[model samples]
Target: MRIGLLSFAHVHAEHYQALLRSMPGVELVGFWDDSVHAQSYAERYALKQYLTPQLLLAQALDAVIVCSETSRHREVVELSARAGVHVLCEKPIACTLEDAEAMRDVCAQHGVTFMTAFPMRFDPSCGELRQAVHSGQLGSILGVNGVNHSENPSVHRSWFANPALSGGGAVMDHVVHLTDLLRWCFACEVAEVYAALQWTDGAGENGTALDTAGIVLLTLTNGVQASIDCSWSRPATYPRWGHLKLDVIGTDSLMVIDAFADHLTVYPPDLTRPVQWLGFGVDPNQAMLTAFLDAVQRRQPPPVSWQDGYEATRVVLAAYTSAQQGRPVRLRPARCESTEDPGDGQGS
Candidate 1:
């Protein structure tokens, strides 16, 4: 299948490019990015660089991965949908709930498959934790604590710290991962959000006023309380880019997941780079990409649907609202169902 990458602004875009090139039956049909960086990438990969999004979409591509900046997702996805191309969009679907809904609605109207790029759902450890909870091995879940901590991406990509481009600071970039995982584990939607945002640093890249750190408290429809430590607290000298982990408290037993724990830590003598983490385990991004390709080939819905992405973004956005107002924000209540799963395969 031929798949073109929409933009190269996202850090994961380069990783996806390498993986796609190595995968069988998948052709990396070049890319289109307005930034001058695209020229270097195109030259390095020896792939055609489309001068415009429309030109790339006109290549009869089966699918496109929208890796544009957080705020530009809608425009790129809409372009692809108009061309009848399936989409695997990067996380946080859009900056606002309205844009997210529109993206979901437009894709549905066009009858094209759309998926959110949430690679953590494909992590084996995370899958086991979800299974344990579903099978009653952990009894009834009472609470969950998840952390998605990372170094400031702005240090490497100027857009990450730009409020206009990234939507928010660390909270916007990290909250979706844990929020989606919690929804997947419990098969329920959040009912309320209470968050506190803070920034030890005066200002981030581009003088963005977005918080550098935050804590979001969520109440699930099923009465489970969850909290996420979404922060850009790591320094450049940190060993790895970041890590994801979660602790689940249940009536019977507790479950903890170190999603990126399958790695060997090395302390390099060189002062230039202090440490490194070499991983030999499964690459969740590769797994997610494979699932997307399989779904496209079989004409089935992708594992992580647009609704899942929208709902996750809603929870995070609500947290921001709660923080700004100094009160909990309540979401529209939904009738609780007894279904064992959320039905989206990747959850809603």
Candidate 2:
């Protein structure tokens, strides 16, 4: 399979590039990025750097990973879809619901697959949790508590703090991942959203405050209550670059899974990073890419569909609306791959 990257702007693009190159039978065709760092990436990776996305698409590529800034996703996805290439777009889908809808619609119109970059669905711990819930081991879920925190992304990319470029701040960056996972694991969609956000200093002007921290409360279609504590509150001196944990409360039992729990941590940290955490395991990103590639090779739709991306974006957008309006934002149930909505979802 021939695949190239559309942009190297996202921090994860380098990892994806390396994974693509190292994976067997997969050709990492190179990348396209107009940023000044493009040349350095080409030199570092020893891969061709296409001057324009069109030139990259002209190489008869099967697909491209769209890792551009949050706001640029629409234009790039459109370009790739028009060129008849499948897309694996970075999360939060887009800055606005309209843009996310447009991207999904265009890909559908062009008959190309649109897979959301939601690797959490492939995480080993998350998968086990899903099984426990589905197999009746968790027995009647009551509520959920999820936390996804990371060091301020502005340190990695300045665009992350610029609302015009990366959308809302920490909330936009982290909300969709947990949202997608919750919807996937519970076999439902967000029926309503109520959020409270803490803004960055001096950024509250014109209602454009960049969210530094937030707690988003969601009521799912099946009436399971879930709360996500999403923030960029981790300091540079922290032991890890990120954190993702989920606790599922059930009538008969409780389940907890931390994505970083199984890793080995070195005390005398490496000089390059704040801490050294190592593991011999399959990363979620690699698994997600493999799933996407398998579908592409088989000429089948991707496992993670466009509607997955759309509804995730919807939840994020709804969270912002709830925060701005100072009340819960009720979401109309989406017509996606969701399970049959249990009428008036009775739960603990």
Candidate 3:
């Protein structure tokens, strides 16, 4: 299948480009990005670089992988859908629920498959925990706790800090990953959220709008309570780029996921870190992209639906709202409204 990249502004764009080129069924037709750095990276990687979206769509590619800024996701997805190209857009669909809904509606109207890039769902550790919950090994899930921490305060791109460009803050950027995980594991929706956020005025060379240090309390629709502690204040000397840990407790047993350790440890009075390790050695981005392509090829829905993306976005947006208000915020049900049609304009 012919594949094209909508934008290279996202850090993961290079990985996607490499994955597309390496995957057996995909051909990297070209890439389009407004950023000079993104264009330079595309040229260095030897991929065709397009100067405009019109040029990229003209390629008549089977799908477009969007790794643009979080705020620009709606525009890219809408444009791709209008061009009759399936889309695999990176997470945090848009800065607002309204835009996210618009993107979904456009894709549906155009009959183009839409998938959000959430690779954590495909992680081996996550997979095992999901299976444990589904198999009744964990009984009825009662509570969940998660932590996503990183020391890298420096963002190569400036948008990472601007609320207008990248959304609220680190919470908006990183919390979506955990929200998506919780949704997939429990099949539950976040009914309400209470949070506390902190920011540092001391500027690190990285111009970050806020250093993500916060705590979030979540009440799920199924009466399960969950908490997420997200921070970017870890000492720079820390070995890992980031840490993702989840503890899911049920009536009878509990499952702990340590993605950093690449293992799932279950506790049944005694903590039993599984003796056998399941390695998610495959490139998550590649795997997700391939799944999107397969859905397009088979005329089936994408693995992660647009509604899933909207739901996840709702959770993150709620956390931001709650944190800012210093009180709990109840989330409304997800909804989409159609917009006036924009005719497809094609060139890559």
User: Against the hidden reference, what TM-scores do the models get?
Assistant: 0.94, 0.92, 0.86
Q: Residue 270's C-alpha lDDT in candidate 2?
A: 55
Per lDDT, the best of the predicted structures is 1
Runs in model 2 lying further than 4 Å from the true structure: 202-208, 267-273, 337-348
> Which regions of candidate 1 are displaced past 4 Å?
200-202, 267-271, 334-348
lDDT (tens digit, per residue) of candidate 1 on 7-47: 98999998999999999999988899999788988898788
Put down candidate 3 lDDT per residue, 192-248, tens digits, no spaces. 999888876643235544646888888988888999898876665444456789999
Q: Which clashing pairs does model 3 show?
A: 55-348, 58-347
lDDT of 3 at 184: 78
Global lDDT of model 1: 0.86
C-alpha lDDT of candidate 3 relative to the true structure: 0.76
Candidate with the larger lDDT of 1 and 2:
1
Residue pairs with backbone overlap in model 1: none
Worst 10 residues of 2 by lDDT: 339-348
Best candidate per TM-score, number? 1
